[model samples]
Target: MSELLDNTEAATKAVVDWLTKKAKTKSKFYIKDFYKIFPDDKPRAIKKVVNKMVETGELEFWSSGSTTMYGLKGGGIQHSSEGES
Candidate 1:
């Protein structure tokens, strides 16, 4: 059981990593895009994992019409100093 859980975690991480990389180049990704990236897994399962990532602050979401777009947080911005702008 523990091994299964570990594999599941790894798979989820793989999906997250893939999405993060894609989002870096593109502003948004829809559910079908995820399915294309990971065709072996069901779309619903992928969405579930994505929701978990959103909850954990690893992903951010926006809605456009009937689609939900996802992207990385911070928008690739990095802060160097607190009051040294």
Candidate 2:
């Protein structure tokens, strides 16, 4: 049980670091973009970590009407349903 917790923590850190440090130039990404960050880890696990970040307000969802992408909160242009004239 403890080992699982440790793994989860490490995975979470890795994802955050990649988003903040490595992918700093990019603002938004598809879920599939995270798969390579943890090549040995299952894609499902990667998705789980990213989703958890989203839930915790560390990341946010950006939609372009037809598609949705993810980005760090306040890191780049955010889409909102306001001021549309």
Candidate 3:
């Protein structure tokens, strides 16, 4: 699963895997970070999939000021807590 991500579909798994790791630490990550992973994939497509993840509750969305971050809900992370801090 360490291979470079090439598509949004593959990226969905990669995001889940990455978030799985973060789930252990309850760490949050950013949308741009996800976008940068798939250099060949369209940025819009990546964002769309990530949004889907959020919609499906795979990833939690946290908004801090003007910044929005995403983290794994599977890890028991809280979006409200993330934004408050």
TM-score of each: 0.64, 0.73, 0.66
Expressed as tens digits, the lDDT of each residue in 1-85 for candidate 3 is 2344445466678788877765666567777777655666676777877888888877777777898888777345464444473
Cα lDDT of model 1 by residue, 1-85, tens digit: 2232237577566766776677557755676776765566666777776777678887777765687777665443221222375
Question: Whole-model lDDT for model 3 versus the true structure?
Answer: 0.70
lDDT of each: 0.63, 0.73, 0.70
Candidate 2: residue 45 Cα off by (Å): 1.8
Per-candidate Cα RMSD to the true structure, in Å, reads 6.1, 3.5, 4.8
Candidate 1: Cα lDDT at 1: 23
Residue-level lDDT tens digits of model 2 in 1-85: 2243248667677777788875558878888888877776667767777888899988887777998788777666454433576
Sorted on lDDT, best first, the list reads: 2, 3, 1
State the TM-score for model 3: 0.66
Distance (Å) between predicted and true CA of 66, model 3? Answer: 0.9
Residue 37 in candidate 1, Cα distance off native in Å: 3.0
Name the 10 consecutive residues with the lowest summed lDDT in model 2: 1-10
Q: Which residue segments of model 3 deviate by more than 4 Å? A: 1-9, 22-26, 74-85
lDDT value for candidate 2? 0.73
Task: Please state the error at residue 19 of candidate 3 in Å.
Answer: 2.1
